[model samples]
Target: MPESTRERGRVEASRGGSVRLEDVAVRFRTKKKDVTALRDVSLDVAEGEFVAIVGPSGCGKSTLLKLVAGLLKPSSGAVRLRGEPVTGPRHDIGYVFQRAALLEWRSARRNILLQAEMRRMPADRARARTAELIAMTGLTGFEDAYPHELSGGMQQRVALCRALLHEPPVLLMDEPFGALDALTREQLNVELNRIWRETRTTVLLVTHSIAEAAYLADRIVVMTDRPGTVAEVIDVGLPDERDYAVTMARPEFARATARIRDLLGAASAAD
Candidate 1:
């Protein structure tokens, strides 16, 4: 559990946006049987906040993200952004996935501009925003590089740039760094934190890594096994001004990490 609602308040105040899920549930019916992916999952992500969801594989972590992105609909309950229910993909939401999902034929610069094109943004404004994102992700010199021409980390950076190019108010990420090597994943975590701090965009990230969840989130939402539901919500008490090395060394980091690990263990045992 969070130490207290007061501590949760301080964490929420740090992040600037609000995301709410009201008793959200998702079920899929196939030819054979029904698969319950999520159950009565309720969460609140404050404006400009960075929240990470962690759980066992197939535990509906990504399913929950898709619900928020309006890629999938719940059988019952509702997901709201600000105060509006999410009925479909919203222009105000940006999504990044496990794979960079960049086109092999397109250059990094073009990939970033793709979102702008989809949104029908003005040409000149699109170009400017694309330039800004590429620069922000440190891909300035590699603007013309194709996905195949870049490293895994670089490819993900392109995806991040693409997601942010439209300047969406909310970002939905599903294990954006899960495919990279450990060293690369750590580096990108640092880069992601920098980007989030600079943009102040509301982010809801789904990942299975305990350390990654602790390193990046203002609050960590842990879920149960299959047909997942919120098992625990932990407030990460580290200072908002964080750098990878300094923040990870804090005692609070260890405590939060331990609590999440225990929750995950309990969840697995209950399976």
Candidate 2:
């Protein structure tokens, strides 16, 4: 018999990556039948590594992030964080969805404080951290502005700040800038890359944009169609501090994006 796909895909976190998935699979059972969303999807994300996941729509990219965040359980195999199995909702992670989802009544500062409040962090400590993040994310002057009063990008920045307010060691972003205009999205991508560097948090981003993935990730994981499995992982080969135009002009950038595009094309065609 051939080696099982699970056995072939199983990977160990030898470099102390802190996040590891071993032969992982997910299935949802409806009244009619069992539907598999992921199968034999194994990967290891190193500590402080910025990894991006790209694939066709409905390829379980978002589902993979939810597994790491402990928001969902695998049907078979394991998801380990710091060598411990993820068993439930992990409060130690920060998640930012495509939408900003800020509260209408709160100012940017208060919206960010919600995280601190939920964790019962000291008011002074939370406020101090909030101030620092506001400055770091270039929102210093807009701290008091309401969500409705800010631009789409600014609102997303506020959401980013809120997510980071707790200083989680891992950050999961699901197309955080997907809703913005191209120019705004490009601006936020630059900001996000900087933020990731300053914080040095492990980042797993799920995005549909190939350019975005190539620009932001240290490595990009390409997935196949439904019952998504890793098709390939491409190293981005760029410096930590990258200038948007300069990096985009580099040969390595083009190569990485092209490879990903090719892999995506092959994956789609194979389906």
Candidate 3:
């Protein structure tokens, strides 16, 4: 997530984020048999809450996001946004993946406006928003720079801005920063926290980093190895605004990370 921008001349406006999953499951049909990816998973993310989901590899962490994004349907139960069922793909939700996925020909500004163009957002408004998002993500001067001209982190920043263009209530990120170098990943984490705070976007981020989950989320949901189910949900219990250095130095941060590590280790051993 990148920081949100004000309406250029007017006051800052915030958006609501809300997501709910009820007894959801997903099974894939293969020639051999059915393979269940998720089983009996239920969760709720209140408006403006930041939730992080973590689990071992192939635990269906990303699958949960897909269900909410309407990219996949559950074998049972339901997924909802604003209380309405997500029966199909809809534009009200935003999604960002591990890779930047920018079209090489498109400049940073053009890439940010791609979503708006597809959604048929007003021309004047879209241009203004593109400018604002670029500035928000600290891409002010690189607006005209093509994807090939940007670094890995900057490209990902553009992707994030693209996802937020329409102010989607539920913003889903699947290990969006996983591919970057350690320094860049941590830097984006700081930016994301600031961005999320300003926009108040309801975020459901799936990651493998326990510390990252603790650093960014209000709650961390740890899942079993496979056929994922919620093993534990731990509140981060950190301050509203966090500084990585200060937050990590706190005894509570150590306790929280250790607790999640123990849970994940237990889950791994069980598998």
Could you say which candidate leads in TM-score?
A: 1
Q: Model 3: what TM-score?
A: 0.92
Full-model lDDT for every candidate: 0.86, 0.89, 0.86
Tell me the deviation in Å of residue 232 in model 3: 0.7
Off by over 4 Å in 2: 1-15
Backbone clashes in candidate 2 total 0
Per-prediction TM-score: 0.94, 0.93, 0.92
> Which whole-number lDDT from 0 to 100 does residue 197 have in model 3?
85
Cα lDDT for residue 114, candidate 1: 90
lDDT (10s digit) by residue, model 2, range 22-84: 999999899999888899998888767888999999989889999999999999999988677
Clashing pairs in 2: none
lDDT of 3 at 41: 91
Clashing pairs in 1: 16-47, 16-48, 17-46, 17-47, 17-48, 18-47
For each candidate, how many residue pairs have backbone atoms clashing (under 3 Å)?
6, 0, 1
> Which has the better lDDT: candidate 2, or candidate 3?
2
Q: How high is the lDDT of residue 258 in model 1?
A: 98
Which candidate comes out best when scored by lDDT? Answer: 2
Question: Cα deviation in Å at residue 131, candidate 2?
Answer: 0.7
What is the descending TM-score order?
1, 2, 3
